[model samples]
Target: MTTMEPQGGFSYSEADFRRVQDIARREAGINLPISKRSLVFSRVSRRIRATGRASFRDYLDYVSGREGQDELKELICVLTTNVTQFFREKSHFEHLEAHVLPQLGEKLRAGGRGRLWSAACSTGQEPWSMAMSVMAELPDALRMDLKILATDINHAVVETGRIGQYPAEEVRSVPQRWQDAYMEPMEMEQVSMAREIRRLVTFRPLNLNREWPFKGQFDVIFCRNVVIYFDDETRNALWKRLADRLVPGGFLYVGHSERVDCIRECHLEAVAPTIYMKKG
Candidate 1:
């Protein structure tokens, strides 16, 4: 068997680098070719050093084995970038409040089930924003049945989302009216998501690169600012997979800077300003 050595007081064998790069490509469609080797090391090497493995091979072996898959996933979450904030994309929230929720609520009141999904929802801000929009459109008593699902690859973020508390600065940009209506000003000086918004969202761990785990269908799917990391094949596959969970003619929202040039065949329409709707 061929053997390798470490460097930089931490030997990173060539094969070990290849394996981790493959893992990122397979899991998130993020191709970490030679140019991104440094980025990979920046994200994962600290953990390898912490494990005292002294070799990337041993680290890879531990992270890739069946019993170690969870560890691998955790590593991916840590290495991946996740930046989120309340109302980060203001127009989308306004679209939901002014246009989407009213229409979806009418259908739900007519005995149709209604749900919104924030796929690739990094740190819970987007889905919570959806929840607030939904609640704002519906009267308080009639809001009990509506729910929004928020999912991300990171288990840690999912857990943090459920707690619905954040540093005050993280929520400062939220409109003052929304802040007053949907957040509890805590004595601890942090902002807590009000029960109205909190109860409306269901946070779950999801690997968007894998099969999505939700049951039934959703009225809308907001998958913004995520497809850029994925390759063309993976992005198309995800589009099809996500469509499987949406009602016909329901809305699908993608990030502004991301789009497939040939998505017309998917029966989607460039409806509204930045939203696409599946054709019936």
Candidate 2:
């Protein structure tokens, strides 16, 4: 068996990662650390080798403009590995059930609307699962009319997410009830999310690294599993930005491996093993 090389001892220099990191920061406000020297090189070194460039610097200059944007998208596609599954973090969903939804339901019932933002939705699963969780706890009236905004940097993935199709493996661990409620079986070893669930989510192209216009505040924002890709400054800045848009007493669900400690305003309350909410 051929083993992959360790993600260090990069062929490229730190300058290479810095250039890519600059692109990410300027575009999505995400920054990569110097420690990921190999990760940076591995993700982009092939581009250098493929183009037959003498150095990473030359290759970077080659990708400086319009064509560069295309290359940039390709880089992010490789570097931003958003590995997620439906109900992957079960406790957060449970906390949403046991605490959040009921109160949010009251707000919605009293002519208030509730909306959710899945900021880094990779392939529609997380946001779709969130919609299912909403439907599971919400009554017919509320569940029938829900709004979720799920955005991603990759336009292709964002478009795919809007279509609400996924391979069967993505939903393997999803509870049978929510799966039945949200997914309609299809041929080709896949399933199409039910129209009701699809209707609730709005998938859009958002460059989180760029200026974000807030149409409204969100009751919950799930930025889960994506922050580990960013540098400390970008992480802290993004956390602050997300906190600003989150409704007080609203929830912020991050990845099992990610933390929000640097941001002083929100206290991490461990309602679930991988789940956290903004302190009230």
Q: Stretches of candidate 1 above 4 Å error? A: 1-8, 33-35, 141-144
lDDT of 1: 0.77
Residue pairs whose backbone atoms clash in candidate 1: 6-11, 7-11
The CA lDDT at 246 in model 2 is 75
- For model 2 the TM-score comes to 0.81
Backbone clashes, each candidate: 2, 2
Tens digits of lDDT, candidate 1, 194-255: 98567778889888877665477888999888887787888888887777777887888888
lDDT of each: 0.77, 0.75
lDDT of 2 by residue, 66-160 (tens): 65767766666656666777876777778777888898888887778788899999888888878888888884634434588999887778888
Least lDDT summed over 10 consecutive residues: which range in candidate 2? 1-10
Instruction: Name the candidate that leads on lDDT.
Output: 1
Off by over 4 Å in 2: 1-18, 31-59, 141-145, 266-280
